[model samples]
Target: MKQEVNELIDPSKFRDRIDIKGIEKSLLVDMLRKMVLIRKAEEKLSEHVESGKIKCPCHLGIGQEAIGVAVSLVMRKSDRAFGAHRSHSHFLALNENTYSLFAEVLGKYDGCSHGMGGSMHIVDNDNGFKGSVPIVGATIPIATGAGLAAKMDKAGDISISYFGDGACEEGVLHESLNMASIMNLPVLYVCENNLFASHLHIDLRQPSNSTSRFAKAHHINYNTVDGNDVVGMYKLLKSEVESMRSSNTPYYLEAFTYRWKGHVGHRDDIDVGVKRGAQLDSWKKRDPIKRLADSLIYEGVLTESEYQYLNHEIQNKINSDWEKAELASFPENEFLITQVYS
Candidate 1:
């Protein structure tokens, strides 16, 4: 099973999968744009984290952008989404305002969470991004409850919870799955299986390489997907998300990916953990942005020069947003107390 998982994650297996047949150009371009923006925003966060500017720990999902893009594309504004520690991609995929994200990371007054919730805690209710927390499994049950609320409202809205492979070990996750399954709630549990829970590889933690087994145990419909394949993810999610929304049943998608950087910071953290240097390089080959862009170029949807120009434009936007956000004032000392709950 472990070997099968390895084969599934192998970059070589999906390298030639660049076809965009039958996919709308608008959706494909949007997916590529979001993926590129998320990667660049995370790179900005990484630089700040390494330079002592960002005090809070940042979990970069450099290689996990596709899951966020594909899942978010299928989501509606009425639906709610929650993300775990490594959720910059998820948040940005919904709300492209990187300025607010930068402010939140810097603890400024105009941040998404009013400056208190650093890189980990972010929120945008208008965009259906309910929140993201650093706590591993805290958002699982909350998302499930949101699903229940949506069901009661009869609005056909769904709840999405994005958690890592490590969160699978938490009891709350299983409980939430069981409850959602029995209640037939409209929830989609997205597990971003990045192959590592902190410094420990998943092989050392779980009997099976995939986390979808738990979904099967809970009798919830599930599928494990190639997280790097944005086109494939979009195709799969269109049906699954639509089915769950209409049927009011829970669904699970465990995205198999690899985080380009370490668990909590910018560095690769490859020194101690079994040599991931080669593996990391291979994963880069399957980079969502590159593959999608290459496919678009190959299919004549975009030229190489056009793709480069689009990247340049996004880079400039990110730089402008970050610069302005960093200059914003931090909140007053009493601000925290006022927002604090009893």
Candidate 2:
């Protein structure tokens, strides 16, 4: 089984190289700016969580921002997306309001979930971010259902479910994949193989670290890539999504990346008892943002001064959004039972 999985991904056939020559300078700049904004916003969240200003448990996707940004660039407003606990990047990439995100984390009434859902249960139906939940594989089936609905409606929309590699352990994920494939549902299963479920590494949890094998079992078309390369993700997804749109078929993408922070919270600690050792440091060196920035510079598409200017602009925007969220009022006492169902 491991050999079959290993055969599925050939390193020689997969290239880290990306062509940015035809990509517009302005678009590239915008992508870089969005990435910086995500980074800074998470940084602020970290500060708040650590200072005890934000009481809710937060999952920061500091190192995995590129995956969401790259995927969103090609997605339509009508398409649906679902994410797991570490999902700030996913929401932000879909052009969801950062202020609402901040407010939701602060449990303010102006939040995306109207201050009720806290960090985990964020939703923006207008933005096509159906929702994000804390449960590992819960959203997989939900996304599959969305895809089936899209197919029934004859809509060109696709459903995307983003989850960590750990979510593969859940039996429902495989069942969802099988059903989606059998029905020809228009869903994209994106497994961000960050190699850890909380503190346990992929090697410790499964026989083979690659999650694409499961996709193969379902007879779904799939691809694996270096998750840190935003441009690479864009290139691969552009083709795969186009194919899915035409055929109304399901596909899978296993993105190999790492998270800078631990499983939960802004802290580097995985938990009170677990040790991460030097893995975090090694992952930092493979930072997606830095690598993409370097590639942009190397390709002569972005200069150092231009990059700095973009970073400054993003920081200012993030600070403004944070301030607005901080001042937003909490939900009124009477409103608590208003949105609830009997």
- State candidate 2's TM-score: 0.93
> On residues 1-342, what C-alpha lDDT tens digit does candidate 1 reach at each position?
332366666766776646688998988888888998999999999999999899898889998999989988999999999998888999999989899999999999889987889889999999999999888899999999999999998988999999998999999999999999999999999999988898887778888888998998899999888888888888898899888878999999988988899888889988646646657888778777888888899898888988889899999999999999889999999886887775
Residue 67 alpha-carbon offset, candidate 2, angstroms: 0.9
Pairs with steric clashes in candidate 2: none
Clashes of 1: 0
What TM-score would each prediction reach against the true structure?
A: 0.97, 0.93
Q: Positional deviation of 288 in candidate 2, in angstroms?
A: 1.0
RMSD (Å) per prediction: 1.6, 3.0
List ranges where model 2 is wrong by over 4 Å: 3-21, 270-275
lDDT of 2 by residue, 163-250 (tens): 9889999999999999999999999999998777888877778888798999999999998877877877888898899989889999
lDDT (0-100) at residue 27 of candidate 2?
76
